[model samples]
Target: MTAGRPEPVDRQLPSDEARELLALTRDLVDREVRPRSAEDEAAARFPREVFRTLGRAGLLSLPYAGEYGGGDQPYEVYLQVLEELANGWLAVGLGVSVHTLSCHALAGFGSEEQKRRWLPGMLGGEQLGAYCLSEPQSGSDAASLRTRADLDGEQYVVSGTKAWITHGGRADFYSTMARTGDEGARGISCLLVPAGSEGLSAAPPERKMGMWSSPTAQMHFDGVRVDRERLVGGEGQGFRIALAALDSGRLGIAACAIGVAQAALDLAVEYAGTRQQFGRPIADFQGLSFLLADMATRIEAGRALYLAAARRRDAGRAFTKEAAMAKLFCTDTAMRVATDAVQVLGGYGYTRDYPAERFMREAKVLQIVEGTNQIQRLVIGRHLTGR
Candidate 1:
């Protein structure tokens, strides 16, 4: 859900250079992503080369530090890049977002040495990463995650299962959440686990309704061993780290939702103007025209919401409520806009021959992922109440 209220008047907007990058990102999506997304969707294949292209363009690391092979770009700029990718192809957008989320534990709380060891690979395409926090029983209630990690001399043996893991089998690295001390949120800890670690395995991907191109699997850590140095933060600091990572991650989802909405809108608008009924373009009709207007309005508004939150994050301001609002608003709007886009296309939109049906399916997942819209409401509700 990427929609949020309008930005304050004094807040700085995208700078000249940032605007250029945004244009370039959107251009790349139109040139590369839009043309290829359909095939990727039909084949249910991951476009690993898309990462190579993005890495070569320095787009993958747009939000990270330049010293670590990243662009060190502002969040405002980086989110625009995300918005563009998502607009053309959600799988790539989600892949980028998950990679960024994985990078968070290392960037925010990891020791300098740890960052040096890991950040470069994550920023580049040489290494792919996943964030493991959601469990089968604990999606909205992340505090109930039961993965366990027990110390065994200098090494720790981590054992548990993480559900709904993006890039689960394909990722080279996993930023995992585990229980290391007690019960509830305070007991959790974050660990950086390499894919090749012994006893670490993944179940075959879950049958998902949308985003079929991006793999989702249940990862099992049966006595998976990690070095003491791999600990992301001090003991029992995992939940705090996860929450911080998610605050930013939600903005990514917000941007992705906007992308989904735009994709569906683009299809609907083009189809409305081309496909004829009653001897005229449907775009000529007042009723459908009004729907298109609303769709366009929501897309722009959703973009503004995530951009606003990203700017706040970049400026070191309190933006949790803003991010949650963006996630809540944008994703809901995407679901609605995509659903309506299909209706605008009528029967043709529902067919697999078109992207709208796929977009509709993908939009529903956005509401479920990151944090469900309900969870986002609770976050916003608690913030408003000072809870």
Candidate 2:
């Protein structure tokens, strides 16, 4: 909710540079992001300029190596910046996350020649990206995706549709996964398809419940020809690469979840303090006060959990289970905190004139994106049980 100014967050940054980065992010959010968030979101307008501004600010490339026009900020620092941006506007924050996710396949697994050719532009933020994995029939079971990329002479001819793709129509590039050989995960391959591929097209954006400012659409590959060099990682390695990227991407979603919840909590607290009831502020009532307390607690806990998972990743430890846990807990927390925020505002919260209702709606998609909460539990369970 953009109803009130965000409360200051006490962040634990690793270095002076990181501290400066956070300050710069806050300044940018206050000046550019917060002011237009309400109006732009209301009109379902995507703020491409905002992303360009963030790109120029070196924010869009944080957590990547600096040699390729990246910021090279660690995951811990990068995630906190995401939290701040999301606190201002979820569409922007999540857009940044999806862009980073799109870059992961090449950044982490591409050949040296591939990196030298494409890394600079993608990291520079002038070009946005989309990750294509989930198909209409295979949202949760991504390995079952039916998109095919068959070899034809020196090029691969792709054919199939990718559903629920973020930045689907507008991205400069797409990191697409398709089946190249036998069925299932072993046959999947990752491809870097440029936006203007001959047979590539995007359907009209989906009318989503929230995050309207970020476009989501189904992308069609009608025999789109991609060069052999565009293959990311080895053939039959796409599923492994995709899973690895999700391990990190889930943390991004977790950070964004905390940001939304933090914004909702801030609005709820501010409203409770200023809006009078029963001849005094409703915040004075024990019932409402306890609810606010619980909301704050969950936000703090979710933030810590995500940060913990991020730290594990930064340390090069296995963090898939932790990432799943963070995604599950933090998104659930956002939903609860946003709902509580509306409850605190009472009748005003339900109205579109206020942002509590919007926050509630936005929180819902977090539970579904990346992987659903049910899928997160499955991941965690599999990790624990050695399945």
lDDT tens digits, residue span 28-69, model 2: 998999889988999999999999999999988998988878
TM-score list, all predictions = 0.94, 0.99
Model 2 stretches astray by more than 4 angstroms: 4-7
* Full-model lDDT, candidate 2: 0.93
Q: Tell me the tens digit of each residue's lDDT in model 1 across 1-387.
A: 111112211224467777677767777776777788888888888888887787777787788888888887888878767877987799999899998998899988988898898888888757778999998898888989998999999888998899999998989899999999989899999999999999999999988998988999999999999998899999999999999999999999998898789878877888888888899999999999999999989888888888889889999999999999999999999999999999998988789888888999999999988888998999999999999
**C-alpha lDDT values of all predictions:** 0.87, 0.93
Model 2's C-alpha root-mean-square deviation from the true structure amounts to: 1.0
Specify the poorest-scoring 10-residue window by lDDT in model 1. Answer: 1-10
Q: CA shift at 204, candidate 2, in angstroms?
A: 0.7
Candidate 1 positional error at 87, Å: 1.2
Clashes of 2: 0
